[model samples]
Target chain A: MTMAQMDRLLFGDNQFFGINHMSEEKARAQAMRFQKTDAIMEVLDVAYAEGIRTFMCTTHDRITEVADRVRADPVRYADFRFYPCMPYAHKYANAVTDHGMVGALRHFMPSDGVLSTALTGGRALATKEVDGIAKVLIDMEMKMFHGLQTPVIFVQNVFTDLLLGMGFTRALRIFHDHVVTKYGVEPAFITMNMPMLLEALEKEGIERPIICANINKIGFRMSGGFDAYLDALRSGRVRAVAMSVYASGAIPPDEAIHWISELPGVESIVFGASSAGNIRGTKALVDKYMGAPA
Target chain B: MDHKVRIGVVGLGKMGLSHFAMVNAHPQVETIACDGAGFMVDVLGRNLENTIYRDYDTMLDAERLDAVVIATPSRLHAPMTTAALERGLHVFCEKPFCLDWADSERLATLAADKARVAQVGYHYRYVGAFREMKRILDTGALGRITHVLAEAYGPVVLRPKRSTWRSQKSEGGGCLYDYAAHPVNLLNWFFGTPAQASGSVLTPIFSDGIDDQVTATLGWDEGPTAQLSVNWSDESHRKMTTRITMIGTNGRIFADRQECQVYLRAPDPALPGFEAGWTVKYTTELTEDPWFYLRGEEYSAQLADFSGAVAEGQGKAVENDFASAAQTDRTMAMMIENAETGQPVGAPPVTARPTPARKRGWFAWKA
Candidate 1:
């Protein structure tokens, strides 16, 4: 009922409490910036010192950069976690693809350009397009799910479908695809990509990886964006809810802070920042709301 | 008795009816003839004579009117006014002379060449509160304006919705074009043409590509800047009002229909504890008259001015030819286009939903 209770539920696990770092196309092009490895570790260290245990980046390219930079220094910063940009990779890829069952499979697959090219060009052993994309997705999950341990996916409006619309509990279990008919590997793992389905994994007494959601849905007012999430929380329909409170900047900071704190089952809210100024402002706001020591 | 002049009315929408009422009521003026969408002709036929013609050309040719009041569709406003001007008739066209800047400029140039009195329907200039603010600015009592925030909001009911004339992009019946005309015209009337405008446009409720909400930042000639918010998707049907706040070098003026307040921040003290902060120097509230004031005072004043202009050959009419109205129209058109395409279409880069420093404490806000 109180905000303190909700904050404890969300942040108590010491899961990745993070601030998003946005880099522009120009910034991305200039590979030579501040010592890439040391700079990233420095930011992770900053987040870690602020009671943050996990770190996440936005794009696949950014994630690869961080993953590559931290590859050698993995043990150097063992206390932190890395969240590769998988959600946007799926969404962006979907935006470009033609609509079909194969396209839907590709929507769940990873954003590795090499893997995507291999599937497209028939370089990889693909029985069919859907099977090919599903194989890539399965391989991706197996590859990263173990390394990252718990990966966070940012869903755009799809989270509502999983939670309130059709519960994905049964769908995750029934993975009778034509890919399995041809290949020996079963692709029941597609449910991991669905936010509500992944959340349900925890309730079924299966310890699934944690998924943080940053819902950047358009037409927040019309889609009943917040109302759906609020209804889910109030009805105890959702178990692991991460409140991306500031996704729509229309909601005032004070009101958002209050609502996030009072939501029944909200876990963590990932802070998005365009610049260091934004991070600083958010940090101040968080501190002000939590009654944390200034 | 003074020799009376004749004035013809065109496109009888709500504004057209106001013009008809004014023309009929005034003693010195004669309503020579008028034309609108057939509905207006029906509305006017009860009181006025059968001086109504369906087509503007027929009305112009048949009636020997000395001047004309144009309240036609935005796309036709420029052409209609231009035609009237060429016929040697003094013209008063509605706000947004053209849907775009180029068209507005062409109309402006045409009006300049003619020896006829021309003005756009920027009636807010004659509004009492605006008139008061103008006086305060002229007196230099408020000092130089540093920051200005002008807000205007109303439901879709203010402007009658038409299928062909309004809904069409060519006709210019979108949010920024229809509702925004008031604020844009007022902004131009209050301040000059904004050097550059950056803003976001949206159609949250309405299915049409027409915008329902818009927030814009206008950079002025001087260092002072302005933020304007105009919305048509307000909760209730009737939400008609324009609120303006101007922050000047010496003082700040906040004006709305309910109350108007002027704040003067006293100079801070050199010492810490004794430092003086901003203080409200003057506050005044106009008596709340019934809704009939719109029909009685505002409409009557505008009609009287138009009648006087027609009779005396010279009088202040609604500013249909003001350069600011044209720029405002251009800004609205550009904003609507920008909303349709994510790219900044001849407009400045604008964030769709920028983090507001202060909350829009409408019914949405709990506190």
Candidate 2:
């Protein structure tokens, strides 16, 4: 995905769910404040009002409510498209805790693929079929986002890092193929360690993969380092989605935007905000620094 | 003979050294130090004429100490604290208390059994602004608190390579244990244990398996709610910044290291010093310049309190004791579990509130 294809300022679900990098106190406050779907929609509406129509969000259970609310009001959300990030691992993890592993798979399996999925799930578990299980699980996760306009689906960092650590490079291919062949949209990967992930993706024959990672001036949470990230961006090999450009609230807004704007190949910047003021302010800053996203 | 509390400090890293300096400077306290790093022991031995050893056990055996300050990593906190308590020494372990809740619980039990002063270093509690906030809250100036927001942000672990023991999951690395402990302890200080907790996300911004960012919501049975957001990866904050905002029925209190702002809808006579409306108090007004201030007033105040407790034979009720610290650890564990499982990890849900009736017309309410 390129800058033109993706929204320069994509709204994120972290704020809606009370995810804050700096404060658990603030996160819990946000969670309670945005407990209702309407509260979440209010923030999304603020982002939309500020000309940010694309929402890069996770497939969290609450997001299904958001997708439903958006789908219900087609006129208002006419231009809205969800960059559905997937394998909200907590959802599956919770399901497995409540119900057994196979039971949880069955619970999430699509209606048409119930029997086949069950057989595949049983065999995969028994034989340790990592790729087969990954494919099935991806399909299962994509089930909630069935009718939404998901131009790009991302593998969340949890699973991405897991696969990366396990050296399960083949799983990335399975996700890419399924997202491309089945959904007809490109697949993206969210990771903390982007350099290694990008190299792995290239080795797997996936060229110019879209990878979202922490790309900031201070190298906050950048796995390799600022230099490596800069080198990767300058190399123009992988498409980069820069998140945490504010470095988890460390850098000043203008400086952060200006620094990131000058970087070579950052295709998009995804940020989370809880209020209209923050949404408007961030959008203006990005536009001022990045020059209206070309 | 000098009537002073003789204290031995173990794990002379960043926090240990700070404590050593504070205790050494106090007129009423004498200090000894130990660390696994021989160079650190040598450095402290050279500076202060106190006994310094590379091994904690050797130092404990060699020195006649009334108390021990344990500033080791979270994984080692429990063992060191238990050993000190068993040795009949008042123990002060740094924040996080321990890596696991079970271990913290065991340590708390040991401390209780030994009848020793066991304080966990939640230095924020001693900070002038937060202390003032706590005092105001105690006066019921804000009425019944409806919600609280605690935040701690810093750029300490911005890169993966900067990962220390704090970045390792086994060693209690990440913002959750290292940074979140402050806000978690603050929340528990304001309100007792949360009745229910959910919607947790532990994000590893730079390193896998190391949570650089943590968010969670805690609900109290008495209607108060709390939110915690801590990100060690935030580069915007030059240093770790902690802020707590409490929304109460009658007013609000927003406090950080710099200042405390309290807003009241109506002045309560119960809170004598506070006015009816908004009041902003700066830390400069509340803080006192200590004779030997090295880190901050809060750090000095905490060490002074620990030393005083030892001197007066009143170390048993040092405010931030192991029991309370263990409660914070338990809540944190629940939040982490909730984040991992995507489920509510605390007590069973209370009865749901009734949904409000939908509006029929703009004038419906007036009519």
Candidate 3:
């Protein structure tokens, strides 16, 4: 997909692509292949010309330059704001130490480690460690987001599999045991995978809350594919789907549009791009599937 | 068919199961025998039934395999691999090849003498993206590199019972032995050898007297410095993401293992950055395929590569050759010695501690 097309689609959907730093070689390769940075800015400009809005990067060292570049050129990329991923500890410290509030920040530290090792070998850290990490992370958030030096810090929970695998059995149980029981910080919203997550939250006594269904689950576990995702959203298994449309790389415009057509009850999908190609493709996909925000 | 090779697996622990799975599913490989602790073999019975042996010697004697993949505990890798090489079986063994540098070097000499296929399971070397980074560094994109900051933070693999072999210092159950190999190997890979290596490690959480966390610095021969922070008592389960920032004369590059992105910013007047100009120009999601993300493919690929190398009749050279693992083992030995002796490992003892740094603002919060 052209970077412009990808940005357009993501802009239409209110999303930002956050790229992680692994190593120098892989980073260099991604930069060359994805046509990121200056090349991607040209795409974003074109996307803006084509009427796309709200471009954002995941506030990271690998993409901070572009996020800063866009933010500086307010006339052309005024709406571009970098959205840093959260659990707060993982991304915020790095952002504060490195980026210094180029854009917004979001935290999503799964109580369990990423990738679900608790399932493989019932070997998760104790509840105290979880609380400690979360508190340190939350303090970081309060310093950055609550102080209003930056924009809002959205705490996201993309997948609850790790928590469930760690034996919470539900998201609400995690909330109660982690949030309510300990920190007493009632969640403003909760995002999760399916009804199982929601039911778990309900069982834990979480009241009617804003729910974000992860449509991106289809991309990773696409065996049952997109229809299954839509079915879950429509069937009340998922209250409101927060669709993450990009993985591996941004989907081409055609595939993205086809993907949107086959779904139902998608409240919003967070689309991110690495290049103008992804932006333009995403815009076309959104225009085709989500239509103009009337 | 890509010249399938027959293989036998030793030590069917987690790593063993992973290797067996890799060999069985790999397009050009066959795992002949899977041997391990009695309970592990019994549980994995029949599924791994082509050939399974309880005794190590019997398995080595009976299995006329092209190669052997050893995933036994750290203590077993050396002896097991040495025996396999002696028997003319190619070997692909797990890291730290041996606890002692002397033993590892001995194995290296044996490997050279045997002249067979041997390869260490430094599986990180086979990571597609990491390989790409090695290529870029080889091309000198970052210029004359000076300093590198690396971290390997995670939870203690040895559990509360403290009965496992991993919890004993005598058996290589320390943070440096278990976790430091990654950065140490990378350092060796990147900047030849260090002129001097010093480390300070602690075992705050575990009662096993093995270090749970370590901070080590290596001064390279080429005037470059590398710092490593490792912990076995991490707050989370495990995260092996290594963050490498190369300080070069012309420009600087920072890479994060989790995001799989590289940020490069050269000296530019237009850009508002310090003398060490920092900006992230490139970003991308690493392939999160379950097979790849779980490191299943890389493990499989290592087997295939090792088996192929063995099939080429270079068994002794293809697996656990020990030369590479020895550098890390030596560095780790230094770390352990320093942690215990209150002096740099392998260095003359000093009565006084070095000048301590001023307590920083973060100290209070951490406290």
List each candidate's DockQ score: 0.01, 0.01, 0.05
The worst-scoring run of ten residues by lDDT in candidate 1 chain A lies at: A12-21
Worst 10 residues of 2 chain B by lDDT: B38-47
Model 2 off-target regions past 4 Å?
Answer: A1-294, B348-367
lDDT at residue B267 of model 2 (Cα atoms) = 91
**TM-score to true structure, per model:** 0.47, 0.54, 0.54
What is candidate 3's lDDT per residue for A125-227, written digit by digit as tens?
Answer: 4454444444544444343222111222233442233332122334334333444343333342323334444554565565443344345533642322345
lDDT by residue (A76-143, candidate 2, tens digit) is 88888899888876666445434444565566655565444544444323223334556777886677
Q: Is 1 or 2 the stronger prediction by lDDT? A: 2
Give Cα distance to truth, residue A144, candidate 3, Å: 35
Q: Per-residue lDDT of B1-367 in model 2, one digit per residue for the tens?
A: 2478898888766577667666765667877778886333433344345677788888888888899998888789888887888889999889888878888888888778877888989989887788889989989878778788989998766555533576688887778888888988888888867888888889988776888888988888765777888998886554588999999878999988767889999999888767788987766457654433444567767777777888888748568988899889998889888987898987853534533448665665766
- In Å, residue B66's CA in model 3 sits off its true spot by 0.7
Best-fitting candidate, scored by DockQ: 3
Model 1: residues with Cα > 4 Å off, grouped in runs: A1-294, B36-47, B157-164, B266-296, B315-320, B334-367
Chain A TM-score (model 2): 0.91
Please state the Cα-based DockQ of model 2 relative to the true two-chain complex: 0.01
- Worst ten in a row by lDDT for model 1 chain B: B282-291
